[model samples]
Target: MSVAVASASAPARKALWKNLGVQVVIAMILGTLVGLLFPSFAAQLKILGDIFLRLIKTAVAPLVFLCVVVGVVSAGDFKRIGKVGLVAMLYFEIVSSIALGFGLVAGNLLGIGQGMSATTAASGVKPPSAAGAPHSTLEFILNIFPDNFIGAFARGELLQVLVIALIFGAALLHLKESKRLPIERGLNAISDAFFEFIHLIMWVAPIGTFGAVAFAVGSSGTAVLLSLIYLVLSFYAVVIAFIVVVLGGICAMFRINLFSFLAFIKDEIFIVLGTASSESVLPRLLEKLPTYGCSKQSVGLVLPTGYAFNLDGTSIYMSMGILFLAHAYNVPLDFSQQLGILAIMLLTSKGAATVSGGSFVVFAATVAATGVLPLEGLAVLFGVYRFMSIAIATTNVIGNSIATIVTAKICGEFDESVLARTVREEMA
Candidate 1:
């Protein structure tokens, strides 16, 4: 611990992009460049990319499960669970609706996917059997609670994991104090350990990002880039507009400023963009929430719930994408039918994965409900959709951050003084 020894260690500790988030970004840029230079090797790079993602995905179910359980059980309140749950569901519905509207407007204005013939490339791939489909609302509800909890984990079902976590957490709260303390402590320890493991694994993110982005760019080449570039740009534009206009208006109504708020979390945004998942920064956000004026209860309640529910970006992408497919096939739809799409989006948007390309399955449901063009039309856009995933993913992160802050302000949990201080730093 001598000053000389500390000084020597400092330089070693300062890695090339010492920040995991920064490393991830550099990896992405380098990966893309490599892909462009060595197109033939792109397929091998994809295997590398898939490995990293699979690692991340494997951890997701456990992470969410433990976090939710620890978050709720640690609150030590039975009634607040119901209260916070209601707030989360309401927030999800309202913001997701706005996102859907934005996508609807953007698709109409841009006229993407318009005037193209339906693709027949996927005609041979049979759809999954109806036995596996959630044919009714009741089936969807019942399927959420798995008969075997371990089976849910094995299957990697996010909604099922969430349900199990919430129920277990609630049951823990009802236990006697003597029994509850031991259980809560053990669960919290496990949650903390898993998060630590994530931090350790994050050291590899920069490398993973490089491989993933490079593989993507190289395999598809500029053809994929050019194909979806417009859609990507338009989607990003819509998200930015939503952040500035809709969320900004919300900030103004509360006498807060959006730019300043975003500035406070610039580092976090960089991390999300590179990693393409906001879940990576959930712990940091929770720590910073108090400084932003949220109460312990509000931060604990709002943030984790928001992850599952208030995915504004996903909602927008789902709506816009469906329309994009509709347009590409020259399928004419009346205004009433378009409105129905929005309604359906409202229901399906919540609980979608925060992972890149996770919305495709849910997108399949919306396509089915529309009863418009053939489902195979989606395959044509599949190649480019991967590139667009980052846009919606970024929007999802930004939307959740804003929602948590705004909700805190509404609940009188925000500290005006802290908000001013944070704003000053952001503006500077």
Candidate 2:
């Protein structure tokens, strides 16, 4: 860990608002104020953020495709690429399980949902439609494989797109070096173009942040938030504990200072918070993690894959939300029942990102599948989803960033000096 002192020779800092993080933070503050004082006006501002999300959604599938494909061919080793992917998936499963079980344990121990039937009399938000909820494990597995290759991209199905990238990478891996280089170069160029596209889109991020936060607060209002303050605070408490205890321990094992690591990615983390969607920062993370000394291959494979497979925060929220419903509605879930829910969540949570409406949609699906938790109970949460998302999305981004670096280290693709350089900036 490098601890460089602040130096007089450092360049003058730009205007604070000119910085992306500053602009986003300012937008959030303005958004909250508007939500509190002028909700109707804030409601109208939601389209601004919707437009930004649409732009990000459109760009991500292709970008993931290109990143994995490019990462695969560029490394020039099929064995190494396969190893990294395998390791990342394993890490994702282990850590996500921990997150799942931890949430249940915490929620149960804290009785996080003990009295919700009386405190918040009416759920402010209407329940979301559960039309896409899968009925069985087999149905969920089949949903992952795309029927049409081009259609997958057209539909912006990330898991399908990921499948295509892996197959494409495998095909390229088998090609003669003479033939592969040209293809790799072409793909690399396209990937660079997409990165530039993300940069262009990012300029409008503050506008989007302002709109998203405004709409969330405007819709829910402080009244709704206060009613369920315990649930909100409890969930936040769990997320913070997970970060400090779980993620912090992982970083410690690698000798990486978690605080410095978080500081290095502060800008992207803020972007996630403002947008309340982890997908918004996908393009930026793809470009940034490599600078942390993680090999491009490891980053390209692990990070994009982590978005769906390794959402520690989402798992915790889903598990806790279910327990909250069960408790609030006076439903008792036995050990076997809770385990069944956990198993369902492990599958549904991975598909949440690929599905429209993200995790909440999937959360609804998981609830419906349980055949016990009152699906109606989900309305109790809908109003506060956006607020919870601010922290949830931040946690997901932080978790994935750490997962990528750890995967890189495991695969012998890390450079200590690069991380040292990154930490120096945080220290300074």
Candidate 3:
């Protein structure tokens, strides 16, 4: 009987090891090792990595659209949804500013870009102003209204889609019940279809993870790793502090246990770290939030919406990195100039997602907007940027997770009793 029980447990253990995320991490490590040892072989495998990233990008827009619509429409109260959104937006802004401030503080103290000779390596990339860039604020606002909805979606413009969805969802909520029910059902069905699509795409997650990690490790290697130890350590330390200080403060303010909240979402953190894209963990985070006292509608809405508005980690990195570069070049800016950066960064961070290299784009835009340093200063940080990307993306994941739960709890959508009971019982 004991042998039979052991045998049954063995298969389950094996199944656990085969979890998609676990498999992805293992694949990433193996791919990295391969790339480091055999660069030629790893180069051949580059297509595999590229395909995986493209796959994630492809799924992102539709998934976000469906989830956001469903989340908004399913809510029992429009006023309450608005309240939750207001709190979330306020939380995002305050925390993001704090993150930006911390980044500035850490970057100045550490001087990651110090002693680096400026280069024209990024010359051909087209500086925002020189490239005849439109006024960003006006452009950003204008782009929110899609001239072609299908075109916007095809181009994978998340901000535009989010704007459109929010407006449409609000309209749906204001409709008379008899008229609204069919539309709600249709939206729900579309959301279900998207979830099914998510499951289908998830099969490739392990492959993609391996590809991303391999590409990063192979392209960068341990030599770069060894050289940037101080900078890496500095960035990570700030990130950790942000999680503990900022998020923890909020959690405590709400009487939520920080440890319990983090413990419940440990797996989600690992996913974001390994993949370096918080969007990759959206479905899983949504699934897990209900278990953490968030209602299904709250989880569904907040998680997707937060991707655009509540990128706390990205905010921190952008703020810190820009200051680090400025300090490195010995560029002296007056208080007014610094204030200009602070103000522009607030808007640039919102447009951060629209750019190709995440924070790098925002960093570039910041340089342009600030007019404080040579634009090429952006590329000077490229080598270390990859290292910083991981830290930034990880923080974004944790911040959003905490934000979702706290917002849900505040709006009376989440169960305090469940949160308290679970923290005492199942949560570590």
**TM-score for each model:** 0.84, 0.94, 0.86
Off by over 4 Å in 1: 1-16, 115-136, 278-300, 354-357, 412-428
Candidate 2 TM-score, C-alpha based: 0.94
Error of 1 at 119 (Å): 9.1
The TM-score obtained by model 3 is 0.86
Residue 233 lDDT, candidate 2, scale 0-100? 95
Which candidate wins on lDDT?
2
**Cα-lDDT of candidate 1:** 0.70
Judging by TM-score, tell me the better candidate of 1 and 3. Answer: 3
Candidate 2: regions farther than 4 A off: 1-10, 119-121, 423-428
Q: Which lDDT tens digits does candidate 3 get at residues 302-400?
A: 776677678878887777767666766778766577667877887778766655556666677677777667666655466556667878888888888
Error of 2 at 412 (Å): 0.6
Worst 10 residues of 3 by lDDT: 123-132
Q: Rate the local accuracy (lDDT) of all candidates.
A: 0.70, 0.88, 0.72
Residue 267 Cα positional deviation in candidate 2, in Å, after optimal superposition: 0.4
lDDT, candidate 1, at 308: 62
Q: What lDDT does candidate 2 reach at residue 110?
A: 85
